[model samples]
Target: GEEAARAAGAGDLNVLIGYDLRFWRELSALVGNPYLSDFFHRLRVQSWMCAVPHLRRAGDLRGRLWSGHCDLVEALAHRDGRAAHAIIAEYNADSLGLIERLAGERSG
Candidate 1:
């Protein structure tokens, strides 16, 4: 899907690839740098926490189910590190809600 979409688009694709946690670490180092700050400002992010940590740390057993999706969506949605984190947070919360309804309770 990514290649197909890129082919259809005219602009050169700029792919940012890195482990979500690693990416967050890099962003953490950029806070004092003006260029990085400017980039985040462009992405409309107010805080570093929004994008970094896009992949929520899995909780017990149930949290494992939501981690990948939360990371992927957040990673793709925002250029800034903090937005990813926020999206992941939202995604994980929503996923937990769904699981609660479907599985009732995960005791084991």
Candidate 2:
């Protein structure tokens, strides 16, 4: 995951997205709940559907998104659930903000 994040930081969106899905899928599976795993899969796909266009428009993605993924991986590695949760929360908020900003640019 950290390697993927670094690739993403180098501007490879496909690598980032692919690894993100895999990361979440594995994490959800670790909970041993098939339902949650399925839900996460669907949710991730839907989010990509909505966000990909905007993301593509941004150019220079190197510093624009998912920079926290490496930190999240570190948190999980250390078994610090609280830190992991916070990192995820921050990532989601940042992603939403980026989408919103890009949408506004499109509309305006």
Candidate 3:
């Protein structure tokens, strides 16, 4: 999370978010189930794709996800599974909402 904050502070949003993807990929690797690991990898890629179009047009909002990442990292670092899950769920919901809003604006 500190790495991400540094990247963001350096004005490289791509690197900032890419750190998140890398973190998830590393985490997914820890899953003993190969199938679930593969699923998480795919989902991470999809999430990255979902952000691409908006990244160019709405980079300002990228900071919104940053704090969530910090909270998520703290939860995971403390081994608080429940808190981590809740934080991740909230992050996903926010991401989905942002994507939907961007899609609507593009279509309408």
Candidate 4:
């Protein structure tokens, strides 16, 4: 994830995509359920792909993304699984909201 942020910071979209894919893979592996993990992995990738154009148009998101991830990591580092889960849920909800808003802007 840090690598992805670095790539984005450097304005290297190609590298950023690669790093993002890797980050999702690593993230899914932590799910502890193969089927469920793969499902989420694919979903995240699809969501990311769909949001790319809109997100790019919205301008740089590295700071926002990095901060979200940092909060998640901080929760995990403290071994607070509940907090970590909440953070993940919040992050996902925020991302989905942004995607929906972007889609709306494009269509309307």
Model 1 lDDT tens row, 36-76: 65565545333324422332222223223223433444465
- Alpha-carbon lDDT, every model: 0.41, 0.82, 0.71, 0.69
Cα error of candidate 3 at position 107, Å: 4.3
- Model 3 per-residue lDDT tens digits across residues 9-108: 5646678668866777777777777788889888878877867767667656545444465777788889999999998788678767767777787788
Q: What is the alpha-carbon lDDT for the whole of candidate 4? A: 0.69
Better of 1 and 2 by TM-score: 2
Candidate order by lDDT, decreasing, is 2, 3, 4, 1
Tell me each candidate's TM-score: 0.27, 0.86, 0.71, 0.66
Global CA lDDT of candidate 3, please? 0.71
Q: What is the C-alpha lDDT profile of model 2 across 1-108, one tens digit per residue?
A: 775678667878888888878877887898899999999899998988878887888877887776777788789889999999999899889888887788888899
* Candidate 2 C-alpha error for residue 76, in Å: 2.3
lDDT by residue for model 4 over 30-105, one digit each (tens)?
Answer: 7688898788778868867876777777665554342254556677779898998998788678767767776787
Better of 2 and 3 by TM-score: 2
- In terms of lDDT, the poorest run of 10 residues in model 1 is 8-17
